[model samples]
Target: MAEKAIAALTEAQASEELARLAHELARADQAYHGDDAPVLSDAEYDRLKRRNAEIEARFPALRRDDSPSDRVGAAPSEGFAKVRHAIRMMSLSNAFSDEELQDFDKGVRRYLGLGADEPLSYTAEPKIDGLSLSLRYENGRLVQAATRGDGAVGENVTANALMIDDIPDRIDGAPDLLEVRGEVYMSHADFEALNLRQAEKSARTFANPRNAAAGSLRQLDPEVTRGRPLKYFAYSWGALSARLADTQMAAIERLSKLGFRTNPLTKVVEDVDAMLRHYAEIEAQRATLGYDIDGVVYKVNAIDLQDRLGFRSTTPRWAIAHKFPAELAWTWLDGIDVQVGRTGALSPVARLRPVTVGGVVVSNATLHNEDYIAGRDAKGEPIRDGKDIRVGDFVQVYRAGDVIPKIADVDLERRPKDAQPFEFPHLCPQCGSDAIREPGDSVRRCSDGLICPAQAVERLKHFVSRAAFDIDGLGAKQVEQFYADGWIAEPADIFTLEERFGSGMQQLKNREGWGEKSAENLFRSIRERRRIPLGRLIFALGIRHVGEQASLLLARTYGTWEAFETAMVDAALMEGPAWDAILAIDGVGRVLAQSLVATMNQDAERAVIDRLVALLEIEEAEAPYVADSPVANKTIVFTGTLERMTRAEAKARAEALGAKVSGSVSSKTDIVVAGPGAGSKEKKARDLGLTVLDEDAWLDLVGR
Candidate 1:
């Protein structure tokens, strides 16, 4: 009786422990993947996962319903519309080691009841480090595109998808409804080019290609998406209305026939050994591939067999992703230096002996922050030489999935005997201003904002950026030339280009690479951009945290340049409900507001603004509708036909008089301005207890 009770208690206790462990593991996974900041190390997370797996195996009869061991990833994001896949595109289970790969292969063979003599064909392809998208075509025309959100419901990105060059507008011999799954990747060359351009323009550089591609695709404006260079390669498929072929190779052939560019490296192998050989070949030549690939993905060639094998909750039993070993190399850490950003964050960068890795010469790598430099190792000793990196110490650098090289380990034995630990400066190297590190942040920042020469040059470049002033023929080199020649110094100086060099224009025409035609083109381009859009003007001002999206939001909200300028100045001078009103703009946060105030208060900035106002024709400020006013403050949801005004003109006029014109209506909507053929927004506004106003009423309220 005692033994039976003990056994029962043990089983119940084991089950409870397993459930608790599973929850913890899932939360950790979410933190790692969703946040990109993992709380646990790889070893610690692996240990916890192994323990949970063991518990689940022991108490099979008492398994929890929501186990981390069972779940693949988080459910689909909520913001996007749901798209149920007819044929689910399952993720692959990963193997970090050759032993693990062998075990995975053995398990697959055993599960399929395959004998030693039985042949198994597999196809291996590169696992791209990019966002997974599913493109659906109906009767040869592209219809929908969705993201791989939780391997299920995905964000509808049809507008952005249309901009991708590789995605065919129409396909030949396609089914009524066919879904082709692929990776939207930014090539390494394009990534480098973009980063160079961003650096020249003093814009925020993306950490990696995957991030750049993802951010570009999520842009609200399809036009903005069209500007980014994005490419795609169809690797798999889902939701087929008509069958293509029996084998995976045949299906790929069919897709190619339908005008899709399938990866040419994909090949049918006779056995697992052949698959491994193909993976090795690919891995060996990965650097020359010109794109970032994290691993090799192998899947069974026969579609019918794959279906029979079925899938687990998140991964298919027939497919596995074998990751390459982290690309690591030893380099001599010669020295360390601090570089200041526009925001004044001082970052420690490791200066190393140049080494070629992934087809690129790497001479410098980010050290992250001081804490990372001084962090302790497994032996409870500081990782860096003498609590920080020394002038001459051998360091191991690693690049995983095209991630920026990071110092992995220090070879103290290889350290030069005379080498000394480097000292960090407390003053800004560029401006000699005192650098200060905030309480929580690891970075030390220069106090000089606009005054720092480096910062000023950077800000000036940002002013004439493509998304800002977009001065044609004024590339980075030209900007540098103008700055060096003392022809232009500030953002406002650009407006006085022709005036400053009116008589000397002939000299510009005679200058090397600047013929009469080029000079005329340059002047014409500058003149053409004088009457700039509100968003472009706002972005050109170089306000901190005000990116292209924020600039558009502020422009749409304010409607006119004067209104925005007045709001910014008012917010800068006063601190109360009026200041709160400025912050109330959808995307304007405290950091942005503070930066704006700081910029406005600077004498140098005020001079630039004054010069700009004098040189350029400033548009008259429009009256924006107020929320409290019966006519002025109403939340108007515009829809239908407007014969008199363009849609843009209508929205601008409505916003000018302090009216909030929303894209969609809610219970808070004051009026629905319907035009000739009022659509869904108009109908929804009426249903949501809001007043419906026609175009005549909208025009009358604006006094048009």
Candidate 2:
């Protein structure tokens, strides 16, 4: 076809052509960047690029800024706040072959007016797959933290940043203003643990460490962010008032002095060839590394030279990110199956034909939920197959840049006639209970709770988790064995194990896997856990919706087990407005409140609790300090911010001295700490003829 004829086409025809080109380009980009799999060869991309360029040259006005021909890569997302970077963060151009890399080196030398014989050094470090963040510290304290929104702007996440233990709050001998750029990442171990926890809670599990870090940082509630384990590794600088050392190695050393966590694998190389060698070394050990890294980032060692090279509209001339080729292969989805999680979430798993992707054997991939399988596109046709995934369907499996494998597409034509639509079971596969999907949720949960063996075992494991009891020598397997042997049925049984098993000591010693030393160790471990704090004890109870932090909050509020139990029973019996007030605590949701009441109402569980309480040496509840002592020995409710301390600290301090902290402002509420942002609780307190204290009053009463 003639160029003029193609250029002079009708707008409708031109648009259709552009749409086709866009789709082709997008697919190519997804394959190359997102999936690490290049569907189109480099020669193919070049041909498409040339054709796109010709069309754009012919129809100049029709081209968009986002056009594949003009754009270097994807634009940054807007989920975060925009920051105007003091120094623009630029992406690098890539080289696929050794020849291309050599040519690039030659061009660099030519641009720098240097001879081929002259020696040049470069720093090579792993390009982590994580969310980029800029941390700005002023006068030794962390002042601002932002996400890399665009190369220029980012989202402000100072509050959430405070939760990361690796990111220091203060650095010794730091400049007046320092802006350090780093990657917020999750370690492989932490990621796995988080996924396990998510499965237990029936929550959405993240696909990879990078996604997990990104999702955790973007949570609207800072309190929620506080619970996730995140780490930071300084990689580069955005803006620093103080000058860095002459070499990249020196700059990293300086960053370490400033208390920033720098990646230990960073090394200075003598040339691009050496840099490539470093890349190979890192790539070879990628599987053994604690975090996911997709490539190596190479930058000019000298800041002055970097400034001289300047930058393109999107990328710096001095730096390059050399990415490893993606591991991809076509695999068939042989069947669909469901796995019952600890929380009874029926996870649809695709059983795929064995294939290797990213150096790992990929047999099974998560299919998310049934809704995702059945959802339709704007065209009213199924996005993948006309029908939901069925047995014996030829489905295309994909392992994207993410670690989790997924079913990307299905070939319906190749599906066998005998194939049947997969039916999600209505009963828990592990426990045989009727699976119950909550009103607004898609996950089908087992309502068996502590009664179900699987759930009970999981709960017991959680009770002794690191954040909970942290009992030594009492691991999950031990707990399961003890439970299975009828040695321990309730939480109380654990405290009395040594005494109960003492008489059978000789028999236990003679049994396989039960030596005198092992029995002694178990007893020692149980004894060490006997004096656990109120928070740990409450968490070990495994109340639904009650996490470690929430358990601590309740412990601080009620001070003792007796007080907490009495308050819960009283709140359940309260009427109308009084009942609503009891449920208004920051962590006390309706679901938790209902679960508490239901559990308390169960005679079987209640009897166990009473027996446990009787056997244990219950400590006295701490009294809240009050100058006037008007509400002494009475329950009080606090809402909103307090000038004296955070709500958490205040609650903790209140219970320490002996005051019952109730969630709601009720007729029984003797006093209320009504600080800034006090909500209905304050009003309810007033209506009920209860005394309310402002920030100053609360501080005065607490004698702070």
Candidate 3:
């Protein structure tokens, strides 16, 4: 049966579809990018994203804030230091069909106001199926390497990247500063050899070359990455002090000349027909290619043309990835199982009869939420034609560079007579806690957060994560082992490990996989993390809604841990100047504000905080300052439409110059940058006798 068209969907239906797409895509992004374990195949993920785009196009007002179209990738994984990209590493829009490719070309011509017969050229190259890496060099020497995390920020993997033979440590003729972007991949031969080694060691093997490359490159220890047969192919560039080339093909040649491996199949084509022909040629040779090639990526050849095309929020208009067809197969749905996540959300996983899809054996797939199994969305809107999945039913499965396969459709005709509708549990399976779905939430959450083993163990993992205390020797595996052994229970227990188990008969050295030296090293790592930054300490608490950014915001707001604690204690009443102050923060809303205050006010949580505080030396957040800058350490408020730059851009610029950007105009505001259509904030600023400047005047003052 044909699926319902986007034009045919009601406004409510479109909204519901958008919500479902957001949830699924967000989870998929986190799994694939963050954990390096993808649950949904790329093809299915793309289909849902395409549907979301079509619906948003038809009903513009229904576009969501967390829209899939506006996002690039998942946030950086937890166990790595984050590096903000100098220039955002944008994702390319995808084209699954030749017609879509044609639309891309036509869209480019339309944007540039060119005729159909306009002379234009494009570079078509094979899109490598591997992790995206950005290498930063200064003075022709390698300085940093990062993963394409959420585009804006990425994981710092400089040491790991330096170990790859294909990457150059230095290039004498390069610009003073340059950011080379490309793919880090493993060959088919290497992947198989790696799996053999894993089997010999009784370790889990990777699902594919992509996963192997990602897992290898993101290892905490650089020596692990050095042992992996990893290679890099430089195809693009990010931040650069000077232009390397004037055209896409020329840039690739320049990168190749600069001691970087460039794909041999990359070619400049004169027209859309030539591009399609090249894509076909590449597809034919894909099997013979030593590495994985997902599809052909096409980009405008001329640099000037690309600049003219510009970019959308997430993707560049000048380029598109023409993906290969997805692989599919039919299999039986053996059963359905529920698993609780760190946040206590009950996620359903489908157990399928082992079958081969895309040359990989698959047995499990994600069911997203209970609503997904029931064949409906959160609002009870019909999905998959209202065909609920049941045990012992034949289902169509698809695979596209993913570890977990996706069930595309269920065959009701083949459903077993004894199979019944699967009942989603009302209680947490791990702890027997009441699992209640909030009014506006999609998934049921366990009420007993503190006592639940699943949540507790996950929180311990987060506490030792890269952005938190980052105890070098204490990783997720060690945390789990210690927790299960009843040696550690809370964050405070980690500080007392040396005292409790260092000298006794049950000493850490006596444990399996631990030597005297290794145990001492672990204790040293723990001791080293005793003096932690304020932002990291806040993020380590595992409070809901207090993420890295919010933690930093709170740290900057309060300056010191003592100030933050005192303010939170005062704000426990939930109504007062203290609470109002938290609500007034630039980016923090009432939701986050309330979460921080409530967590600090809880007696159990407060005790935990006190215990950790007693053992650790928390550092104060240093005020940002720029020499001779007028707005240095001053508060500035932006009001109305700024024609020169976006609000985000303005705020970033202000922050860069050591000026604090406040959302609302207050008596503390030193300057107010107001543009046309300035409203209440601007009026309030003027009434308060604060300095006011137009966009041009503000720009001039900043010397932009």
Candidate 4:
């Protein structure tokens, strides 16, 4: 129901809704945490609980049984080698009940040598049930991030951390060094959606949102982590260049100003009673919150006092985690389906008979991968009780603090006679292309290059996407329609539409769903995209390995399309300086370079490129804009680099910050970095009166 409708409900109506909500929520909880499979998605359950909360908030006295105020916590998850933390990340003491919380408060007061009547402020906030992370920012830029592995040591997750949209790539006006501590968690909605996608492709689905977040952050491929819907909440600081604030709440507020999403419920309470009240309030609000939290955390507000209170062997003496008890349920696994992703990875999704759990209906879950379907691990070892999930199997599903609805277990005794093992297609279902799984890779991929209809359509979609050509009146539908009609087979065909069909015996205006004005508008939209940046054009090509960032890197390195095309053609001929040049482009490695050259080597691809080039005026990529840098957007040269870094390293570093690093020092050269050898290029720079920097000076200039 709409919020307005729910709000306008009479007290009697609300009371009746609450009663139903109580029963439904109870069932959902049992299914999510019990021996039975869950019947509700995390989002569905959260919405129902949120609805219950909204109604209860409006009519507190009319609240029914099984309210969120009585709920509790569950157990918590992933990959990678370990990196020791600079400082130990201590855990918090646990307080399961109000009496425990009070005792913890008393312990804090007694330790601090404060009288029983004296006021001792504490910051109470929701303890998100996800991975703990420590982000180290150097000179206002994120440098490293790590997972809390063993308090004293953790796995480096810097690459994955950078992928988080919530974490800033670069912060303005920050300290020289800052170590921000926070939780990286997935929301209920994102978790459910993620699981559905996972199940659709027959991939390994996460048991809960916590596992999803943890696994995402620990992925060896940062690109994989980038795809996950992970979020960060900065609650505290481990190290800082300067003091953030005197109080914990104020420090969190400062982090908020620095672009961190801090919990809104954090408050400075005056006494133990306020802390308990806040905890109860937060618990009631948990179902409505998008993220999963086991309980409310309370810490000494004063930073100085926190330091004085010190830590125990494992947990901090000044902080405590007051947990709520956890919530599971039984559901039927009806069937399984597959879904292909943008790059063509298949995932398996579970189709379930609709069941009520936690007061909401769950009709689906994730089956994960082919191995999961066959009841085996990645190595084909027996798992899941050595029984494959059948179509009519009774699966145990659960939703903990995390909102993802997952199959905890499957009972095969009730397997239907019609049940059969799912056969994963070796060919892409959408394009008839061979879907191959490479060695050391878990996911399979479509190998049709740009020929597959699915890949082509997806490419066309990207070509006209907002970040690419962004042609108006030519969305995905129009592109697909045009493609199916054999009117626009490639990017260039889009530009040829007006000339070919603007006014003819078979005009676009004559077609169904097309009018004279609309057809003209479509042509106009295509015409507007005739001139685009080289980077955007490269990105629109939809090469297998190249992404937006990689496209931009190539564009910046070559500056012009002609230079880039020539280099690529040369590289395709044989491995030499040209291939090395492509590989030398910081982010571009041998594999990516090979993928790019392979695309260019195809005759059909080259012909398409020729047609596209003939139709448009491609602009040179703009130089990197390092606003505060001395060499940004400037043409420069490096000569006689005798120490510190290799010549290629210097070129990559300079080009990354928008400097044009040329092979030779010429009249156009803005500056020349001259090392101890003092070569002829250095002399030329002096003759030209261009600025010359020594190796040491150059290093200092870039903050290296």
Give the Cα-based TM-score of candidate 4 against the true structure.
Answer: 0.50
Badly placed stretches (over 4 Å) of model 1 are: 1-126, 129-171, 175-232, 235-292, 295-326, 335-337, 369-387, 401-403, 438-441, 503-513, 601-603, 617-704
Instruction: Report the C-alpha lDDT of model 4 over 1-704, residue by residue, as the tens digit.
Output: 44555666665455545544554554454444321244556544555666676777787655432244233211111245566777777766566568878888888776666789997899999999777889999998888887776466677778889999999988876678889999999999999999999999999787667767877777889999999999999998887768888999888888898888999889999998999899889989988998778788999999888866665434677898887753467877877877554455565678878765543456776565566677765445566666777777888876534344656677766667777877877888888888986653445667875677776776788678644687878878988888998988788888877677654315577788888778767777777789999998887886654655567778887889999999999999658778766654534644457768988888988888888899889999877587787778787778885477656456756765668666666666787899878778899899999999998888888877
Best by TM-score: 3
Give the lowest summed-lDDT range of ten residues in model 4: 69-78
What 10-residue stretch in candidate 1 is worst by lDDT?
1-10
Between prediction 1 and prediction 2, the one with superior TM-score is: 1
Sort by lDDT, best first: 3, 4, 1, 2
Overall local distance difference test of candidate 3: 0.84
State how far residue 450 of model 2 sits from its true place (Å): 4.9
Superposed Cα RMSD, model 4? 19.9
Residue lDDT tens for model 1, 1-704: 11232233355345434533553555455433333333333333444455555555556544443455555434344345566665565667776667677776776666666766787787788888777888999888888898776455566788899999889988888778889998988988998898898899998677667767877776668897898889898877888887788888888888888877788888898876787888899999887998878778888888876764666646777888887766667888878887765556567778889865544345766665565576432223444443456768888876544333667777877878898756677888889998876543345678887677666666677676655677778866788677777777787777778877873488778778898878878888778777787777776776644545456667776778777777777777649655676555533555556666667667877777777766665454244436554567566677887777556556655654567666556665677888888878877876776888788876776676
Tell me each candidate's TM-score: 0.51, 0.48, 0.77, 0.50
Ranking by TM-score: 3, 1, 4, 2
| Candidate 3 residue lDDT tens string, 1-704 | 12344555666555545655765676678778888887777767777677778877787655654577877877797578999998899998899889999999998886677789989999999999999999999999999999999899899999999999999999988999999999999999999999999999999898889989999999999999999999999999999999999999998999998999999999999999999999999999999998998899999999987865667657888999999988889999989998876667787889999887764667888786787789876667777889888889899987766646667788898898998998999999999989998665667888888789988888898799765888877888999999998888889999998887653325567788888778777888888999999999998997765666568778988999999999999999999888887776766766567768999999988998899899999999987668878788888999898886666567766876788888777777889999989999999998999999999999899887
lDDT of predicted model 1: 0.68
